[model samples]
Target: MSPSSSHSPSPLNPSTHPWRFTWETLAHIPTLRLYLFRSPTPTALSGASASASLQTDRSLLFVSLTYQSGDVVRLEVPVPRVLIEPDEEVQCVVRSDHVEIKLSLVLPVDHPVVIQYRAAMGFSGDENSVPISLNDDLKSLSSGDVNLYCKSCSTKLTKEPLRHILQMPSLNWRDVAENWFGNCCCSFGAAAEPGFSFEILSGPMYKSAVPNVDSCNCHDNAEGPEEVAHTSDMHDLNHTTSNCIVSNDPDRSNRQNLYFGGGFVHNDTNISKDVEWVEFCCEKCSSPLGSYPYWKDRGNTGTIDGGVRLFKCYISTSTPVGGSDDVFRNYTVQNLFSNLLLESAEDEVSFRTVVRDLKSRKPMLQLVLLSSKAWYMSGTCIENHATGPDCQVELQPVVKVLFSDCSNSSEADIRLVENWSTKCHAEEVYMMTYEIEELKNSLSFGKQSMPLSCNLLQGMHLSWLNSHGF
Candidate 1:
């Protein structure tokens, strides 16, 4: 009857291993199961034309489930296929030997989806797989200008506008003239009276402010006074603008004093004081009628009276009292030489009688030679043909010849003689052939004379006569 002999074990003393639990009690505890599934529909991968299929056995799904037996379990289940459409739904199913369960699966069709596959890993198992779109953004942002702006930053953009200028062909000279002249009055009118209404003068002529009157002169009542005044005013205005005066009117002599005024008079006197005067003499004859004073001597003789009378002198001034010196000097020299040579030659050869007489007549020839040395010393003839022999010469020095009987010699001979004489100074024999040709053409009948043999001064061995077939 004591407790030590009792068959029942005490619950507090687990060492006796007292109570045993039944299977029904263990089955009543909670347990978890996981499952995976795939849709039967087909799906297309990006950049691929064919529909993609899923492997039912190889495709996997991860699940987190708890069992009623107070245990946690993770399961990987195979999915058959994944369906893709504008909108579609897929579901997962979990089952055991006794009961079945279902849950909705979130497909990537709701947003952008990335499907990826990884090989079996370590103890952690394979990672979750997803579908991805490759190079999607690169294709979308390829072209056109892109403007970028920051949401929270202050930035400035600068804009520039282009300008263009164009010229038109319709513009004319009148526009330019008007722009230049403005409102200035034209030349030629009655002189403006004091207190006359005026405006500022504007034009190329007027440098300073001036009255808008027509002219400074107050000439009255001539013929067409207004026109004449206008013309005169234009002339004066032109003169003032050019800083000089030029006139050709016969009346200019009388009006010279008025035009020149006291300022010009003073200038003229001042200029005259600086000038030196020297007298020129006739290279042939020393005469006073042709003699005049000059500031400078050109050391040459001039012709006068159609070469019949030799004027040995000319006036000179250092100041520019006339036009260009070259023009005047050249004209004087040419006139003097041509007239003196022709006259002196005519006198010596009796050319006037030869021209007047037709029949052959004897000529009294008198040759007067003028040497370059004569200009430095007294211009006396060094060689005189009148005192020399009467025989015809082949070549002679330059001389002024006078013949008392020119009728016997033909004009051809006279021309030949002149050319031969002139060209001989330079030793040019080619001119002799030309003169012979001229003589043959002028004479009624005669054979051409051959040219003289001559040598070049610089190249003495070279003969121009032989080369020219002269």
Candidate 2:
């Protein structure tokens, strides 16, 4: 049900028919509500296996509604089932356990064909406002989370807390015991968003220095994407040039030099063997973001845990505060890292995304990483001071940390979620259905909520990923 102006929406027994009295308060626009059974133990979103374990009749159902004028507003609604029907009337009535919530899209859709865009929070349209770089906005922030979304598809990737990420899980853990004890469950609670917050962490990334002659050869040797001429209405960031902010820069925050990272485990079990690095790409577009190394670093965290390398920079439309958004950057401890507290999964490989090896028609397995459940945006602001000629202060977004556990998923039965090209693109798809019969392993069965959805690489995501020139 929609929120009331007098008070927040309270839980009401749907059988009592009290919602009719509150129906007058909701907006006139059409709304879509998704319902999912919340089992006592959290499970992934794939249909069959997850459904088997759930106590359907008794499980609680959380509801999240999205009001789309033109574009799809991807709320953080994680449900085992999604039912979409046109609005006959502005009603979302359901049974008591089948809870329903309503939250409209943040912006008003004026354009005839408005595809949602994930602009930095501070970049709102106000003529008097001075624009700052995303990097500048992030650095001055005290403590908060950042929302990481696909730039091309605007798919709401995740919202995570900066404070919780800065506090624990210092390094990427790789043990099942650690996974069982230290867990982060991504239950949306009354917060109507669909995507998980910090359970499956993602951040803006850059290309790694390591050379991969096969796909992305981006490294120190790689030049940035060509200049992207943006519209005048784009996020104006001329005021945040390094020269301007450097003079007023407070805290001179130490750039984080290292943090935990993860990737799919391949052959070359021994660290001494040639390292097999797991290259990370944008799920939608397939653009190379960074790499998670397969070899554990004995010098840093014990040999089994610290091996993945993350390229943390993605040159955007505007130049960054202190530097031009030109070259790709390697991850520094300042950008990401926390106290060297216990609990990380650097060795355990739970989920897998398989692609085909064109040379031999063999299956190539890539493990996914569980970073931080941190999302920052939607509330960041820049207060321009009238006293000083160009004084500006950055406001931090609200920070929240949620967790997920994928500890029980063994044998990896999650192979059914195929890549975008495999399902959508018929001729371009290289891997036939019969190729990887032996490796059709199901995910480890566990009581965790980390790997909720399998990301597909297709459409705008694929186009943007393949576009190195952009």
Candidate 3:
């Protein structure tokens, strides 16, 4: 085969050059780019009959770098079929000529929940940002369409919102529902009436029985009205407590008496049965004054106000009943109601925090009530103003109203006197009363009763029971 003296064509001809390439020439070629993609880890695939159905087919890849010479050559390569498994290492190798490239295929196991959450929220910008992918089965579970569990651990991973529906507090369900619907519909029905109302019964009568100036003793140094007016002009100042300033004044002691009345109404239907009794307490203090049977009068009233019409209506009997001594001493209506509102507002804040925490994937513990104090403070200011010196100077005290914390404690106590006269000027009035004995009989006899609690704030600890008709 000595072709130097022969007319044979060169084996390195252009047409055959591709078959004559050496290993070094092929080694300089660009590296093959391999891309492997698979569905999210099937922790558990719903509708699968058994664990064996969870397995997926192995993927294969091939790449041709160069045309081979007449001499047939075969390269041995090992590829990883599974990227993740228990007690297994992901190892593989690709062989070319005398060189072998070690490859490692590792599937990430700790996928973040935020990735799936964001995706579910309709994010589609970047894959690197989403570290986890939710399967259709899991998505269905979160959407209230189904329930799912993890196959390997048999753990329930998702549930329906209905499971938490019954957890609403008995006392709060009505208000909560009202607020919810208010936000949704932008209008309210008769249920939107204020929770409290009261009317005045009578009067501006003076303490004195006589209308003549001679009947009341004037101080020895006191001047007559004319003299006092002259003195005021000379002094260039007005004295607020001058007794000689009497003008034409009618006798108040001769006027007739007055009366007032009204009560609260609850619209919610769900109420718990475990509430044994309700303690009406002062709105300002936490003291317990008295206890009434739960739901005594689904619409009954209590005569806690003496002759006053202010009565304890909606009552809850199923509340855990303990000895008066066992009750918290300072539970006042004001404090309890304020606290209830505060806690609800706090929950809403915590919900927002939960949403933020989920986004950051960071655990949080401390939750603060942002609006509770503000509301209480505002209420205090208004109450103070209503009972301030200005009001005292304009109105005369008539009948006194004593407020007590219905609980066993002495912490909640309030005193208020009727000082303003009503526009009606009626002396006689009718007030309703819920007989305690009657309420007790109803509970003992298992008769239907109102689920409202007169003592506890309407929102704390009883909403769920109320909504579920406990």
Candidate 4:
């Protein structure tokens, strides 16, 4: 998509302004990075709360958004209640574009975050202010005597005026944006395509053959009930054999595959010595976000360390070096990793299957084997064949069908507009048509019998897939 769609505002100046009077001041605050963000459940290991895991030694204040054009304006009030909602998204207006930015509500907002509402989106006229008397009710911002309420909702938010962590000067969003354009050579080559842009918050940072979070699948059924009981007893005999096989947190599967999906930039300077992984934070907000595996940990395939480059998410956050009239277009992990994802399909495990196990407190690796396949299908039926003048044929599925099988005996059916587009780019219109299969392997927690099945069925567009060497 053209970065300069009507959805995004045009370059503003004395005339082509997306916003004029109220938000014109924001053109001065510089570019603020808005990571494609969404909230998810925290892992038990991280004390699993809804918060960013930033670990900065220096007193830095920021996470990854850089500016390329225009300016930013600091709202005197605390971070508005509107930006904090998962359902409600906020955008930052830079140059001519108004792109969506993330709000890290779970992370402690130490001070006031700039209200770019007027900037990202234009004002709704004079109807936006509070009913309270501005002259009499207004109090000092620094003394903690005043409270800020959301323009959308009246709830009191914070006491800080400007975010405390970083008082650093905001950059010209256009400058950085342009730098990225040249860095990427061209926008498409950089893999920045329009889609839902989000930052990777958790799960494995780097890819490896032998992952620290290893999960296994049980593919065979025990011979009999007595045998099942015996096997269960034998398996229960040691945590090393069973518990580790099942691993923990089935939710991690979804985290690894679906949302926050991005690959690591090799030869990273920020990588930690820890074998399994290292961490990354927003260079702008100081919020700990991404991570990558050490070269040694990834076995033979990884390079040690260098300038870390993130490819799956939006590749360019800065403006072009020589400011191009073009606005920086938003990109997504799906578009960035499209080729690799199609090649990586398997029926090993699906989120729908694991979630059922989560509710039942069952291990996905107990005794199951999974295999999956997907494709586009069409079926034709003539509606009024007998009446030749009124004969017509129609396809039943308006969208594509994602049919999967889990636990051999169990199956799942899903519906979607397209395969490649389903990954965060569009809504999932799905239905679990089949009843979940009861575990035949699960004779008892002490025993095992059935090899469960997981059929991963989402496939790429045949036309696109074929061209990509699928």
TM-score of each: 0.12, 0.22, 0.13, 0.19
- lDDT, candidate 4, residue 204? 16
lDDT (C-alpha) at residue 1 in model 4: 70
Off by over 4 Å in 1: 1-313, 317-470
**How do the candidates rank by TM-score, highest first?**
2, 4, 3, 1
What is the number of backbone collisions in each predicted candidate, taken in the order shown? Answer: 36, 64, 54, 54
- Per-residue CA lDDT of candidate 3, range 83-127, in tens? 323333222222221111212223321233432544565543323
Of candidates 4 and 2, the better by lDDT: 2
Against the true structure, candidate 2 reaches a TM-score of 0.22
For residues 367-417, could you state the per-residue lDDT of candidate 1 as single tens digits? Answer: 222221100000111111114222211111111122222224587855654
RMSD of 2: 23.4
- The total number of steric clashes, by the backbone 3 Å criterion, in model 2 comes to 64
> Worst ten-residue run, lDDT, model 2?
460-469
The lDDT-based order of candidates, best leading, equals 2, 4, 1, 3
Compute the lDDT of residue 73 as modeled in candidate 3. Answer: 19
How would you encode candidate 2's per-residue C-alpha lDDT over 1-470 as one tens digit per residue? 32321232222212222111000011122332323322222122221111111122322222232212221111122211111222322234333222223323232222222212213333333211122233543343223433333333433333232222221233233232124222211112233222111121223321111111122111121331111111111111111111100011121111111223332112212222322334445556654433433323322221222122223332222233223332222222222211110012222322222344323334343323222121111111111111213222211111111111112224352233234225533121112122222122211111111112211232101000000101
